[model samples]
Target: MTALLTLAVLATLLGGTLFAVALDRAYLPLLALFTRQRVETEAPDRLNRDLAPAWYLALAAIGIAVVPFAPDLALIDSPVGIVIWGSCEALIVLTVFLHGWSPNAPFPLIGAYRYAAIGLPVMLPSMFVLIAAALPAESLSLVAIVDSQREVWNVIRQPLGLPLFMVVALAMTLRGPMDYADAADIATGTSAEDSGAGRAVWQIARLAMLVSVSAIAATVFLGGPLGPVLPGPVWLWLKTGALMALTVWIGNRVARTTPSRMLTILWVVLLPLSFLHLLISGLIAL
Candidate 1:
């Protein structure tokens, strides 16, 4: 039984990794083709080559880490679970900066700067939720949190935490309309000079990574791996996919905003909300 469960988790992780690869391959090319058309007309083409491979690889790595860690990871249930999980999130953020800066293009560089600038503040709410989890479990291990939530998902008790986590995750991924950092209209976005295989990797990996991160967040804070009729892992995945759909739909619906405005919104609006959520979650823990 243990072996079978392990295999199932491994398979899910593999599927996520492949999905990331496929998405990266599919989209990077389209972006390149679009840029080519613009370049041909002497309009402007900014996609850089350096951004693709590394970005895809980074996405794949995050996919591997976030997916398997959802329902179970012995390490994440240990004393240092918080540090491990938080570091994992930080790594993903770092990869975003790397993807933005490595391109050596003006737009991508600017995008990286914006990404770094806004990333920290938004992550606070999620971080606080994780901290709150530590309070109850008396440990940082995710397994402990899951065990605690078996009786009730954290979302029920900490409603605000989920939305804050979602917003941060979406903003970090820059999907849909939240893509102010890489807003295509800006004429100075992160992926302005990539092409061919490189472009393919970046686009595919990024979308996959976004989906994977959403899934991870859902599992961690949204009562992942918990359902009465369905199996725990299956329930976790369903919730994760649902969240991804929500993010994509939301992303598509919103109009593009300027980076400065996005930053302002995060600072003035989202930050306070996130901080409030954290405070409330702390009270819930109490």
Candidate 2:
């Protein structure tokens, strides 16, 4: 099980960066992780600046630990894996905000507030979609959730769930249209002051979160580790990798809309729709 977990973690962590590096501009940022000097802002919260990246990465690790490599096999197998993952998602919002707040700069603060505004709204749809996925399994355990999809994956069972959850994916990973925290318009947002290894670690943590979310998405909606012939871990790795690629592709392609418009859409449309998805799922399960 340890070996299985080690493989899964390595595949997830490295794939997050390696797949992204294929993008033309991404390699330099990675190279900078090693070669660049540490950047500090005026009156920065030194503690948070250092700790936020570590915390972000740790949360990503914790999120991955719950993913089952095989039946009843995981690093920290919990019955309420969905909730555990959700908790991590919630904490990330705080972490990103702190990353901005630590810099004590106007642009980063703007970025931080923007993220909070959007990220908080996005969480409702996320949990709703997750709960909708949980309906078929009648259990919150992710392994059970995966087991429930042995015959029919949730993407097919609950068609609305995956697309809605994609918003959550984009938000949690702080990428694509949802990446208000690190948007270029705001001077890379919360990371405007960050440089050197500190910035690199944060970037890597973001990618790791992206991988973590994709893996969870694979587990809930795509019948994780359920492929024929291949070992469970290998199948999981493939599914996770595919989802990672799909996520990055989508992030790169999508453009960010204005924050005010996004907020209206989230509250007026997605939140209610996701709630309906959960309601319908409950009825179907019953």
- Top-scoring candidate (lDDT): 2
Q: Tens digit of lDDT per residue, candidate 2, span 1-286? A: 5786777676666765566556425777687577978977898899998898998988888888888877667777788999999899899999999999998999899999999999898999999998888888888899889889888888888888988988899999988999989888888999898888888888888888877888888888888788889988778778877887888788989999989999999999998899889888888778
Q: Please, what are the lDDT tens digits per residue for candidate 1 over residues 21-93?
A: 3533443445555544221112232342354446555544544343334456531235555566566566656
Q: Which regions of candidate 2 deviate over 4 angstroms?
A: 2-7, 23-25
Clashes of each: 14, 0
**Per-prediction TM-score to the true structure, in the order listed:** 0.78, 0.95
- Model 2 is weakest, by summed lDDT over 10 consecutive residues, at 16-25
Q: How accurate locally is residue 154 in candidate 1, as Cα lDDT from 0 to 100? A: 78
Report the error of model 1 at residue 118, Å.
Answer: 1.6
Report the Cα lDDT for residue 190, model 1: 70
